[model samples]
Target chain A: MPVLRGFLWLLGFLLLGETLVTLTGLPVSAGVVGLLLLTTWLRLHGGGLGDIAAAAQPLIAVLALLIMPGVVGAFFILDALEGQWTAILAALIGGTLLSVMTTLALMRRLMGEASAPGEEAPP
Target chain B: MTALLDHLLATPLLAIALTLAAHAAGTRLLKALGAPAWCPPILAAALLLAGVLALLSIDYADYRRGAAWLMLLLGPATVALGLPLHQQMPRIIALWRPLLACLPVAVLLAAAYAVGIAWWLGAPPEILAALAPKSVTAPIALGINAQIGGPVSLMMGGLLITGVATVGFVSLGARLLGIHDERIIGLALGLNGHALGTVRAFEIGPVAGAFASLGMSLTGILSALFLPLAWRLVGA
Candidate 1:
């Protein structure tokens, strides 16, 4: 039953995402939008998505590992990257700093207080 | 027959085997260095595999053949993010207003800043377009690039670089800003770093991981909805 619920959650989310992408023409991928919608719905209803969430946790935990192959795909185009390494490095550093700053600013505003260094929030 | 044998033996399966071996070794090495949390397995794997491929003179296509299964797993892994989001739904709902407001602003700033810096540095249009989606997750970044006339391959590269850099520097940046709150640091990392940031968050603690997941999901959604409009405003 737990497995069935997990599978159903996956199926339902993918279908919902597909429908939204087909209908709305949003720039976002349907899968992502579907996840958001499912999350919202689950939260609003409460306890409904519990079984599925439980079943899905292990799968998601190692999600990063799954993308390793794609990362390895970089070898296919090493020459192209090597040629543009300078621009690539600059973009990465500059973009990352910019993102960090923007996010920090947003956090400061939202929390309305300075957070202590290395203080983990309560769960 | 010799060529075929070599191809079979030096395939992506070999690459995967090498990567996993490197990750195991790297983890132990990192732990020994007293930097357990900073042991970036992907980066280590990439470096190790690159060395193996260069030494063996094997083409990437042969390697990709076996490694492609990893890519396919990406779709399911992304879908699995739904479970975390679902579990944290209550907190997300309570914080909806602030989350929504912060998301668009964060997405726009992230995209604009990347493009702005790239243009100032006289980067090519292709590179600039790719950098525009650097802060978003790779899957969505790929979609955004396609929508806005950017090169998907370039965007993927940008996404990789961005994720690595974000993961590398997030803790340092937080400390520099005197941010002691793990939740904020985690949320900020996930919001901007995507999957890579989430990994970092998990290293910090469960609470940080939860916030990171929350921030990542909200940011992905908000960016998807608003990036197109942002492109139009810039007349791109």
Candidate 2:
């Protein structure tokens, strides 16, 4: 039953994702939309999703590994990137620093407010 | 024998095997080094694999032929993020007002800061455009770059770097500030780090992971909607 339930959930997720992708024409990917749909249904229904989520977690956990091959392709393009190295470096270093600063500032503000009187910090 | 060896090497299965091996070795290395949980195995694997490919002078297309299955999984994995968001809906609902306010601000700040700094550093126009969407996840970031005529390779590099830096630094930043709340930490990581940050959050705890996933998904949407307009306003 657990196995069957898992399969069904996977099927549902894929189907919904495909349907939404076909419909929306938005930039968001279909699989992402499918995941959102499943999540919403699981949240509202609260059935056997915990088990399903548990099963899916490990696969999703190592997702970065899945992109590694694609990233390795970077080596092949080194010469092309070489000519533009300065610009690439600027974008990476500059973009990263800005993201870090922005993240820190927002977190500080949110934490400050949420910690205000009587509202216990969320565990 | 050489033809058979080449065929076996060219298969996607080989790429998957290599990736798994690299990831396992990288994680073990990090553990041995007592690196924090936020040290991403993926980032390590990418670096190591790039070195291997370059040293051998293998064509990327051959590597990609083997590794493209990884791309297929990206969609499904992105969808699965919904489960965590669903679990955390109550907390998300409670913080809706602040979250709503924070979403656009966070999105704009990330996009602007990346572009502004890139420009200030004298990056070329194409590089600046590519950096504009670096905070979002790969699929969306790639799409946006393509649409805007940015360099796809540069954007991919930016995405990987952004992910690693966010994962690497968020925990250290939180520890430095003496702020240990998992939810806040996760939110910050997700908003800036995207998927890589969310993975880091999961190591902290389920609650942190949940919030991180929520923040990641929302940030992707928010950035997609507002980033272009923000870019226009900045005249970039």
Candidate 3:
């Protein structure tokens, strides 16, 4: 019953997101819109919603599994990828390294070396 | 053997069952082997599923018939991220100024480099579009891809690869730069790697995990809202 309640809440928000997207023509995922809406709701409500957390935990834990099939979907389009392997590999490897390095440098510059006040180094 | 394979594939739940089973086994195997942070369970599960599908001569379309049911859950799973983002609000707020400063620059660079490199290499427009949002999580990446006009499946491939590569790169880069701050490391991982990076961040520590979650959520929201507009503005 609790999980069902949580799911209902999630589904309701997802639907709300879908409605917003259709109405406003937002170029975003309904789930993301739902996530933002939920975050806003929680902020306005000023506390955690236990039921939502309960329902969300399992889903979040296996988030990778939820995405695997889509990854596998890549195989379905091998022809499209054949000639583009060079580009794909270059973009993936080169782009990832660039992004990671730039983000690290930026964060290090903007945030500095120290942890936040009252925050000890994580063990 | 062929008859058995056909009947098994014909079963409505076959894809879902295999996916769940493969992921579970992969998780266990990784745990048992003490696999490195970059080698996520999804990687192993993907390999397992791909091998099984190939060995059985099963079509991805057929496998997808059942797997589609599982994919439906991705929306809810993405929404679930709200809980962590909400719970970590205070920490998020504390770091908001720096994070906000870093996010747009980080997000744009992440997308730009991929799109730029691929474009420079004469990759097709479709591939470019797919690469544009590959740094974010899959749900958001797929959504952005749909709006921008690309192969959603290829986008997923890009995302998975990006996630794995970012984790490895971020970890190694952190070490090379002597950056021991978990927050910085975690944010970098999540910003570039998305979900898989978040998973690796958790392995580092709770502080890392929380920041990684925050990083991933913000990147997803920002990309979801911005990438399509950018794609359109570029007249693509």
**Leading candidate by lDDT:** 3
TM-score on alpha carbons, each prediction: 0.84, 0.87, 0.89
Instruction: Report the lDDT of model 2 for residue B65.
Output: 75
What total of clashing residue pairs does each candidate reach? 6, 2, 0
List the per-model TM-score of the A chain: 0.74, 0.73, 0.85
Off by over 4 Å in 1: A1-5, A44-50, A75-78, A81-85, A113-123, B1-19, B36-39
lDDT of 2 by residue, B123-150 (tens): 6777778778878877767656655657
TM-score per model (chain B): 0.87, 0.91, 0.87
What is the two-chain DockQ of model 2? Answer: 0.48
lDDT of 3 by residue, A1-123 (tens): 778888888898899999998899766678878888888888898444888878887877777787788767755566756579899989988999998999999999988886453274322
Give lDDT per model, in order.
Answer: 0.69, 0.70, 0.81
Native contacts recovered by model 3: 0.76
Give the least accurate 10-residue stretch of model 2 chain B, judged by summed lDDT.
B140-149
Candidate 1: give the clashing pairs: A116-B180, A117-B179, A117-B180, A118-B180, A119-B180, A119-B182
User: Top DockQ: which candidate number?
Assistant: 3
Model 2 regions lying over 4 Å from their true place: A1-4, A46-51, A74-77, A113-123, B1-4, B55-57, B231-236
